[model samples]
Target: MHFDLPDLRLFIHIAESPSLTQGARKAFLSPAAASARIKALESQLGSRLLYRDSRGVELTPAGQRLLQHARLIMRQVDYLKSEFTEYGTDAAGHIRIFANTTAVTEFLPEVLAGFLAERPGVTVDLQERLSRDIVRGVLDGAADLGIIAGPVQAPGLQVLHFSTDRLVLAVPLGHALAQRQSVSFNDTLAYQHIGLHEGSTLLSFLREQVEKLGGNLALRIQVSSFEAICRMIEGGVGIGIIPESAARRHSRTMQLAILQLDEAWAVRERSMLVRELDALPGSVRALIDRLKQGV
Candidate 1:
């Protein structure tokens, strides 16, 4: 069967979006045109590629295989364009990363600052997402790399150790929980708690865990950053659960107490994820290497 790059690209867009109309819009084609092209592609390949429903479309088994190949082909095509373009100037590339709250807020800023300083020709697009979503984005080619926390079961992705993260309760110097060495997260739910802003991955994870325990987090206030959360706790507004790294950094000036969590999930191993480390472009691989070195 014969198909063109546009056909492959259109299919990739459709699979990523799982919405025919949205995919057509991304490809700069009308819905009717996109549907016709998809029909033609199915006829040529002699396979039913998508299962359509009222909500959206889902890829069939053959479609999943085609998607894997399509992503690889597009990545190679992009690499070729970048390589040829660099003949007239310094090497240039872009990498996309999806990471969780701790990696995005506590870790990546310093690491990326140094990485970008040395490579003026390179750029990065970073987004904060839940660990599960981060894995899916990397696997589906939406992101070039991912940083995830806790345990992950990824079948086809390469995992690299990044760092360890611990979630702890931060309280004012004389708070009742502050006198204790450690406590279950459930024990803190009765007290008012400061929290990160809505939609933060940490806040979302905390909510999920609390729900599992058949309780709710009594959030007293919402703030934008971990530093702000520490400040709020220092002022005796409420206690908050924050990454241990942030707690240590802010504790130097803020009379805050860091108490370890008893739950196993509170201690997490952060890891770097990539679909195929060897297949990545040189510039992308270099950044990963730098991150591994703690630079």
Candidate 2:
């Protein structure tokens, strides 16, 4: 039995996306065309691949097995293209990275800007995820690299120290808690909070902490970036938990107060994870080096 690369790619997209229509759009195929192709593939394999429903599609057991092999093949194909770039080929390189909220918002922008400027032929798809999810994404080959925080437990993946990330409480200058040097997370729960948008790793972590303490986070507003959260806090809309770097930087120009968190989880050691370091493409490796330099 022969499996076509395009068919496998389409299947991968379908498995990753929420719906067949969205997957078809990603693969640049009309819905009918995508369905026909999947039918043909299922016929060739003599097994059902996906479960269709009104909500979305779910992969069958057979589909999961196929997805494993498909991802491996696609990764190899990408590596092949990247390797050719070393031999005077103009094949563009693409790197996928999954990172935590702090790395995404505070650390990566400047570093990626410089890296992308220097390598016009290289492209990066950077996503923000929980640190645990970042590890899973890298280990599953969904991302070429992952930037994680706090304790790491990736058994076989190569890990490197990235940077230190600390969480802090930001309040308006005249707020009652502003005079405090530090405070427990639960202590701040009584006041309204400016939080990062939903799905942010930091927000998720804060929610988890609040749940553990049997308290609810009183989120006054949810903003897209740490800077926005700082702005909201400065305006006395609410106080917020944000990275120390962001709180410090914004405090210089905004009427905000930075208070250290008293919990052990507040201070995190960030690290980078890869399935294999030497196996990474040259461009991906170079970007890793740049990150290590804190540039």
Candidate 3:
């Protein structure tokens, strides 16, 4: 059966939100208009796509099948728009990028600025998420690229090494470890530490390193973002170990002192993730090339 792009989009939105009003808001249409469109789509396809109840909307069996294809179709439509718009335009299109907090606050601003300077027409949309979620975004074709610390071991992803960033200890200016040139893993264990919330890759890496040194890192504050952790550090909540790049960004604003970790505990590597090596768009390729060339 033939289906228009708008119908496909509305279907996907309805399936995602499962609320007629919510889907209508997303589609910028009134609830009545959205419902009419959905009913029209169902008529054309000869199936009931959704069932309404007191709780919310639920998808029918056929709706479930159509939802997957609808997402793929929408993604291809987006890719087509980006691809055609970027051609012969010196990067005049949307590039959706996903990154972790560290990359968002520390690394991406400069890279995006340089890219936009060279190609002023390009628009970049950046979303901050955990590293694993960033990878998932790329893999699912929701984001064109990802900037994260690795090692990420997804099967179908093309990983490119961007730069190495060490993990450093950030202490309040007057803290005892502030004067230390390098802190041992065991030394960090002696203090109450500020850590990223559970499921964070950086937190896991730090925990593993400390455990290896037979150090029980006591986590005092569990924050979800790097900025929050920095503020906590600034408030003298506890010392934090964060990416050197991120620590550098906050050093000017907060009365924080950065100390290097012993080489054994130093975490490094900022990797760029893409869906496939051969599938990169020209705009993405240009950005990656710039990163590799350090231009």
Best by lDDT: 2
Candidate 2 C-alpha lDDT tens digits along 173-196? 999998999999889999999988
Candidate 3 TM-score, C-alpha based: 0.76
Ranking by TM-score: 2, 1, 3
Model 3 stretches astray by more than 4 angstroms: 15-18, 36-69, 86-89, 179-181, 184-187, 195-235, 248-257, 262-265
Candidate 3 lDDT by residue in tens digits, 54-120? 7779999998878867866776676666667734434766678887666776667888888989887
Every candidate's lDDT: 0.87, 0.88, 0.80
Top model by TM-score, which number? 2
C-alpha positional error of residue 86 in candidate 2 after TM-score superposition, expressed in Å: 5.8
- Residues forming the 10-long window of minimal summed lDDT in candidate 3: 86-95
lDDT of 2 at 83: 81
- Which scores higher on lDDT, 1 or 2? 2
**Number of colliding residue pairs in each model:** 0, 0, 0
TM-score of 2: 0.91
TM-scores for the candidates = 0.81, 0.91, 0.76
Candidate 1 runs further than 4 Å off = 14-25, 28-36, 46-69, 80-91, 197-199, 253-255
